[model samples]
Target: MRKHETYAQQPHIRIITGACPHDCPDTCAWQIAVDERTGRAVDIWGHPDHPITRGRLCGKVERYLDRVYHPERLTRPLKRVGPKGSGQFVPVSWDEAIADIAARLQQIIAEYGAEAVLPYSYAGTMGLLQGEGMASRFFNRMGASRLARTICATAGFEGLTYTLGAALATDTEAFAKARFILIWGSNTLTSNMHLWPFVQEARANGARVIVIDPARTRTARAADEWIAINPGTDGVLALAMMHVIIRDALYDADYVARATVGFDRLVARVRDWTPERAETITGVPAARIERLAHEYATTRPAAIRINYGLQRHAGGGMTVRTIACLPALVGAWRDEGGGLQLSTSGAFRFNRNVLERPDLLQGREPRTINMIRLGDALSLDPARLAQAHYRPRPVDPPVRPEEAGPPVKALIVYNSNPAAVAPHQQAVLEGLRREDLFTVVLEHFQTDTADYADYILPATTQAEHWDIVKPYGHYYLMLNRPAIAPLGESLPNSEIFRRLAQAMGYTEACFTQSDEEILREFVEAQTDPVFEGITWERLVRDGWARLNLPQPFVPFADGRFPTPSGKCELYSERMAEDGYDPLPTWTPPATRRNADAATVWQQGWLFCISPPAHSFLNTTFVNVERLRRREGEPSLWIHPDDAAARGIREGALVRVWNERGEVHLRAHLTEDIVHGTVLAPSIWWNKLSPDGRNINQVTPAEESDMGGGARFYDVLVRVEPLAVASEEPESTQQAVSLA
Candidate 1:
């Protein structure tokens, strides 16, 4: 045998540790091997030592070897040679790329001010050090722009914080003790597959699994009972459930009298929302609603597995608030497994005070803007622009304004694709197209967002980086050590940020700290008695660590809710102070009651475009040949009745249009979705069609007036078959429609 082959076949192998940074619930830790001589990755597997993942890697991370070694992976920097989003570029040296980025950013700061350039990102990557914290510090030090990230989880956090004081949850390991598990608006089997095993274990140990959703998902199919409700009517169902629990005297009288302050007001509010009233709003039958309420209340240990999906509507905050109150009412917090379980990870501790350090930038002004309202901020509407107060300011300007436009005149996008991921793709594209705004993208391949960049920088895969992860849905900390060197010239996000900081002449304590030093600093900053003896080095060696808790069942017992009033504030004084309802109340989503719904969905109603896990995630895995071939072209899912009503047969080309925009996709008629709602996975427009089949084309950018969460599901649209084929190929099975 050849010497290399013999060496490769040896039992001994090197271990590379890293975690998948996608905005997923699993947060898997990966192990990779490298050939000693060639220094090439030979194998990839799940970390056996990982606490939450437990040696299980998802399809996405399992294919990281292929993704890193893919022929099309960006190996060097490239400069745009054609118009924005034209997919034309010329290779450039690292020096040239850095110089160009730095010069443009400096020019923008000098001219339009820092706020003109917005550094927008999301959970495309969730690495605590490299993803959000480091990026935010770098930009903040530069006095660039502050993107108010209130779109996704801010509303839920704000509401929960007001009620609970701190954003923490009883660890998922406590699931084994749960008597009843209520899965609400979440398909854990598909989205959070890693947690399914633990859930199953809990069920096997005599836990009743209940699913509450508008559609029957894989999770619902596996549940003991599936309560299918109407889209955007979750708030009403929750309120009605509260009414039933309160009316039947299911609540813990002692807990209510001692631990809760607003029971009287909440009781008055929910009195009108009977099971019958909820049945009218939500499609779930009155009997089923009552039964589910009874089961949840009667079960001694009940837990609600809340997902982020429920908050994707006009009244999303209110819905979340209503649901959050259920556990408190039943005094479920007294049990080990009976409490509200939102996505709270205790992996790495975060200290926001690090960002406020004066030594970092010494007085840099940052332009600030609300991230949820990006379309409006970038729009031509003079009134909206004025309202945002688009003005030039220094990094640390004297008078701190309430709202300013994105100060970043130039942006360095790493690990995110906002063009395809953000609401209203057209507006996001337009904002990037601003001639004065210089944009740089770090990516593995040319994505929808990268196609619009002036410069594209290569990035390393998870297997090629050293990192750590803590799941947002569970409480386990994991350490990741690099298995192999970055392919070609590709570097980890940390190296990239370090180089950028060096280039910008930032040498303060913040930028000077290495990744290891930062990790140590973060670990030391944690003062929570639960994490007393934990250290960064110990965490790295042990692979995983758990936060020590003293008698978990006693946290919310004895009327000890951590609120201003020392009780669960069902009637939030905070909300009332903000001129909003204090009680968890039901308000219909604006779109359903809007006059536009009738006009938009004249033929059939608009569908909620929840992207499938196999296909989308900021459009990263969708472009992969294997996954794409498996998924094929994106299909619009509609009920058989709706499809037949529009004279659109299954597999037929159809146009789905609303006021915002239109998209053409092959129609797949099924009962998987509700009667009035359609299901379309968010995919790349260029990959599917030129006429923007990207579902966000039709999704409105309206923020909930109550909590500023994205009103994504609050949309109305119609579906129809294309009349002609020559201009729009029927052979290709393409559909075309517009407002």
Candidate 2:
């Protein structure tokens, strides 16, 4: 797919069309070009008639015109001239930053209400029509607070809508029609990289793969076998490979009796989870879980994929409802690339109340919040943000922060950063050092949550605006129009929520629609039969479409599954009527291994933290300077027997830490992870680390088990070396001191 010709060698060099709104799982498409002789954006790639981006583009959008002509993008709006986390600032005027963020969100909803206003976001520009569509209908017409958006695959798509009533996937070209793949806790070569060239063309037509993962990734260096396993014991290796596929009978008994129902209570709940109790909770051995459950119950079509870092731990939703009942006990949905992916993104029905209008949430219960407790809702306490009351279960009867009600006092933060990917990190930097929090941050860079903004604004780049995408790993339906226009005074997050709903006067018709008429009324409010006959003039003349899925789709191959008895729910009275575990097992949380690596290694705590970066995604391009000169610094890996049980050495520099924050890296000994685990991977921003903090500063607002998700592989930590490569970074009582 390499063909290029510059007919634009004439008329002002044009090109255009877009998609990669990067919170990736291949929403690729691409195009760009634009040159009016350096009025900028000269070339980005992929899109040669994309179908799951066949025309190639990763390694961060093939350096997408070096992060959209990076001269540090964020063109205007700044404000905060120094002090809060201090990157400092100044410049302004987008009508003076939308009339001072709509008069400090109408004076925090007239003094501490509208849940004291909070917004924060995710997928950092995942662009479903301006990511978090019109900032969730301008904070649900400003009652401003409900954000649970379960940080990444809510416990594996609520364990595939409690056992395959949904969570589809198996067609992004059916993993090249698999013979046996698996890959599990993903790193599909640095995250869904076009499903690793169709699983390397199904391993060059023979297929096999394997992987599992407790690290050793780059797709377990292109696996035929990797298996490391241990962090939150992947549902003890999928209940010891479904107890060796129901003890060697090799399952699929007449497709588990014509498509599942509690197949003998999931075979008496895998008898006693054998394979020597999943090789002592997945350090992986019982003879490789009975020879990979007899080659995944006698291979045939078999597949697996499964990611979202194994639900991000605390036995992540019973390890994704016990690995989605192992492809319905090996019937593997009767073929095509067998079953188990983890997010077909609920088969795209995007009307989303035409992007979160929620009919103006006038029924407004608004108070939800959970984005991993944005550091306890920005250090709550303006009398708990004028308490209206909240504790129904926030950690089962653990409510006390004076029963938190409000205290955000207007935050907005589009497409997230939360002090470099949240979760405890010095209590989200002391709740972003809350001097009566007002923040704002739209961002493009100045991120570290726009250095604790008091307004940072200036967004743009998805090659400067217009969006409409869909990709929890490919099904297509793309379009991202604007290739240039708003690069300075940069707009489009639905025109910055249509200039903050016209500086908060909001005479709403969905705040004056237009962005191709709200993407043609969000594609004529799609009524999902995978968008039958999909049109917005056939997505503006085929810029990208693909949803009608059929050929080799094999959707549960005729067992009829959208649940409530139209099959496949291997034991689930809707998961014991929603308190979970009608069958999905692996209980695991008495604080998993209760992290006592011997008084947490005599109290420096080190067990592990930070992980998404086989060249960065979670801190997207960790400030790309050509992917930080091809990701050099950020080190840690560990295991030369935990770097000689932590006197650490190979390249030395250490620190790590625990009671919730501390950074410093370097170590790299590696058995490719698993020996009291240690990795780190890249996180950057703390002024590109040397430890002013990154890796969610010792990561721990904990959560996950059923999807409040944010465990960074249940971080444990305790590293240590620095006898002085000019040591520093530790203080916050030596990072949560124990002695």
Candidate 3:
């Protein structure tokens, strides 16, 4: 195959509709170019009519056909032929593999109870049916341990939900109508890309774009202003803004009095968080903070695009909470596009209970497990799971071990790569390596997580499956039809779960529904007036449709919030009952508190890891040869000040480390990052690096203060020229940078 050769082009080019299912906000509606002669997909292009995407695809998904046909894609069941983590496996027939897995699952359930099996997964594929539809039904029926799926947005979403409510806020489409847009902690151009065009449109319409981030990201570089605040101090900044708004009498008094319950209480609490006080904490000048607050207050249709990046720290939840309250303070909700825009999955109604029926549990409330604490869960003895040292993040009232059963004995991995993505990688890897553990990984590639699996089952790609799309960032409900036949023995995530249910002799009719049937159930259950005329037929024909919302979509205009009081919860009674501050507060990252942790300087340098590069999506494209070439190798971004201080030259290989772990990478000295902060992006496979290590090597297993989310940015480290060490490094050393 020549570099420019079109792989077996056909006489007729037929276009088929599909939606990208990778874990992303903008679920772009794309058309697959099928070659009639070869029966191969030639290209994937964004649909021109998509309201959000508008004919352009993100860089990561542009060359998606390459990913679909990648040579290393897993196509058959594999049995481990070498020692664990050796990446050695022998292909086996589906019958042999399914029987083996069914027998092992039965044995584990009989010996340690059903709770011994933990189903580990996340949004590797964001398709509604494949993502959680079938997986939930199967796991619940098995009476297996319950998993707490709150890794990325838990802290931020929980905090926002505490104030505004889940999936209730300004929609992404309203960004075009905003007079002022503040993008906080998000690289919109690189990550939430489709939204950037709208921001640009607003800018062209005379709106200002202000980006608040610790580093000067690609999006920040193109902004009207960039506030390089210290990490974890976002809450204090929001408070200071509120203080200015109240002290200067800049708030919408009429709106606040009618639409809020805690106006007076909030005013009193924020009186102390003055701009000067926040200046000292956030590193943004007091004058700048004051100006920002004034501009935001005065702007007619001010919109704030808050993402999950800042909340990756210990106080992430509180940070989002404080920031989310700002637009409400200025009465931004009165305008069609003027409010905080986080998620829009609430626009439609879905039968969630139908997808993952808890009724199938047969009265079993198993011990709740937090996916973030995989390391700790693996280390504790099975007998002690419900007792003293095993305190998993309690979702609701957590079930006791005696009633739920034993610790996890079998881990079923699908739609996620925990060994690389899970916090406390060392602990996660140790648990994966357990000889007694029966691990089953369903994946398209032999990922780091798959390397540890006792049975590796091949899973279908998005193009080879049927699913439904409901994006938190967009309002369209997309139906994904199978674009291609399943390659070899690969199966959709739903089919795998369905087969497992049958093997276990489950008599429930719920397990027998095909992916399409499950999708039809969800669609027919929709009762939201927003989808008044949006039948399944209309969606399939149009490829996408905006909800039947009002012209402006000013949902909370009349102060009808989703809260108990039907008003924004600035001072939440719910938080007070849970032993948290009713008013949002700030807590600095613990690692940044100690001055001499890695240096004699007053402040230890904060190593910020993000995937600003558009080439990768949390290790999904790490295996693609073309994308990796385009991205080059995983490298570290060091500030010029830090690079000069450490005697490291630009482009030279350097080592970065703390107590958690260490890695060697090429140094890129630039002013893009804050003076005291460094940056990196990735999802590169461990085998790609010379030392078999990546950024997570040094990232610890620290959980956030509120949501038990991984504290990824709460890290301090020193960068120096790479020097070969006498000792060997951990085998689990890997790389992943999600911006």
Best by lDDT: 3
By summed lDDT, the worst window of 10 consecutive residues in model 2 runs over 385-394
Superior by TM-score: candidate 1 or candidate 2:
1
lDDT of 3 by residue, 559-620 (tens): 77887778888999887776578886776666545442233233334456655456888878
What are the runs in model 1 whose C-alpha is more than 4 Å off? Answer: 1-12, 345-349, 355-365, 380-382, 386-408, 551-555, 595-604, 688-692, 724-739
Residue range 555-574, candidate 2, lDDT tens digits? 88777788898788878786
Residue 93: error of model 2 in Å?
6.5
lDDT of each: 0.70, 0.75, 0.78
Q: What's the lDDT for residue 524 in model 3? A: 70
User: RMSD (Cα, Å) of candidate 3?
Assistant: 4.4
TM-score for each candidate, following the candidate numbering: 0.90, 0.34, 0.93
